[model samples]
Target: MSPVTYADIEAASQRLAGVANRTPVITSRTVNELTKAQVFFKCENFQRTGSFKFRGAYNALAQLSDRQKQQGVLTYSSGNHAQAIALSGKLLGIATTIVMPQDAPAVKLAATRGYGAQVILYDRATTTREKLAQQLASDRQLTIIPPYDHPQIIAGQGTAAKELLEEVPQLDLLLVCCGGGGLLSGCAIATKSQPNQTNSPSHHPRVIGVEPEQADDAKRSFYTKKLQTIHNPDTIADGARTPSLGKYTFPLVLHYVDDMLTVSEAAILRTMFFLWERLKIVVEPTGALAASALLEGLITIPDTKIGIIISGGNVDLQQISQLLK
Candidate 1:
């Protein structure tokens, strides 16, 4: 059984009732015509903090005990999760500290600080953020809210799929971007089972995780069935640059997800700009990972109802144009 269940996602939905944005489910005529399938884009790019990270961040912070809340929270992230924790902590009257890579997107670093969190920049080549965060957390007696490993975090991240399926229940395939597998693992639990007591395998959509070819840890781990790790990957998709899946997330993803696919850096950029031009929405490289899989023909599920989770919209304007060239 999955550590996070459909009921857990439903509870998260209740907790996020008015707190989180019910981001739109968008359909593009151009995309549909090109792909020859009905596609529903879960536009989490428009979500609070400009990413689906807010759903899990808020859920985890909100459930903290009184003592934990007062002690404050600490986390490490490449970008979106940092901003989400900062904003969520501010909203919930909790203090937050973030350990971010020095080279994280300028926009993300700015947004995280702008949300009122103390930011500590680190060199990924020299040291890991996890070690820094741990030392700080131990010193300050702060509660550690890791980016995607905790049960509440996974359950909260699952709400994105819960909302998507609530709007359109009969999808043939669901594609989610995988980093640490927080979003993908949480979503897979929700996608695999019904709300009721009985488990029906036939009705569930095949949940596939999409990762950058440069950082294909999750993809390699999926088929190997053993934990895999990658060193500092040089991909434009900074959000998907995690070394490997987490303890909680690895098991859930291995158990629930149907398959894993990888797309090229060029494909991600092509898809990101394509959406900006076509959908008129600003999507970051990580946000475009899953969409690029189908749009760029990395994988094909023809003539079916497909759901793609657009994970974030926090674009780095400074890098966007230069990356295309």
Candidate 2:
């Protein structure tokens, strides 16, 4: 059996009730007209901590044992997950220590600390965040809640897709941004396992994970059926720069996802700005990955109800201004 199931997601939904935001299933007439398809955007940018990572973080932290809660928790993340863990810990009254990259977005870095978590910045070239987290976890006797690997995290993240599917019926395709595959795999499980809500020929929507071309490990892993890795990729999508899929998420993604796709840095930025100006949604580059694929004509499935997950809205305005320079 899979480590996480649709039932687990459903249960997580109950646990997260009144905790995690249902987010929004938003439709853009401009987007639909441009694509010539029914496009529903699952806007997780409006989620607590400004990202869907809050769902998994809160769900995982909420289930900690009484002793574990007292002892505290530790984690490593680039940005979104860091903020998620920090905010969740604050709400749960659990102490949190986060090891983050020195180069993580300033906005995210400030927000993580703003939630009352102690932030330890590390040089990505000098040491791996994983090793730092492990050492700190052991020294502090703190439980480790990985950003995307645990069953509870996966189950929690699946709730986003469950809500999206519930709001928008009969999606022919589902595009999700892929980092370590927590969101992608979790969403895929919720989507593929769903019974056909329409009289369509397929059992479920075709779940496709979108990644930056610079960080194509997930794409390579999907096709080769082997775990892959990437170093610090030079891309604007900081959120999708994860080295590879997690142990739990890899298998889940391979089983549940139909395919994986990659988009360029240019496409990501273009889509991000387009959403900002046209759709009036503040999307970071990572948030634009899935939409970029569709908008850039990477895939053309016409006259279908397609669901695209906007993973986050957290962006460093300074960095964006610098890019504009």
lDDT tens digits by residue: candidate 1, 124-176:
99998888999999999999999998889999999999889889888989999
lDDT over C-alpha atoms for residue 217 of model 1: 91
Cα TM-score of candidate 1: 0.97
lDDT score for candidate 2 against the true structure: 0.92
Give the residue spans of candidate 2 off by over 4 A.
Answer: 195-201
lDDT (C-alpha) at residue 91 in model 1? 96
lDDT of 2 by residue, 71-131 (tens): 9999999899999999999999999999999999999999999999999999989898888
- Candidate 1: residue 29 lDDT (0-100): 96
**Lowest lDDT 10-residue stretch of candidate 1:** 193-202
Candidate 1 accuracy as lDDT? 0.92
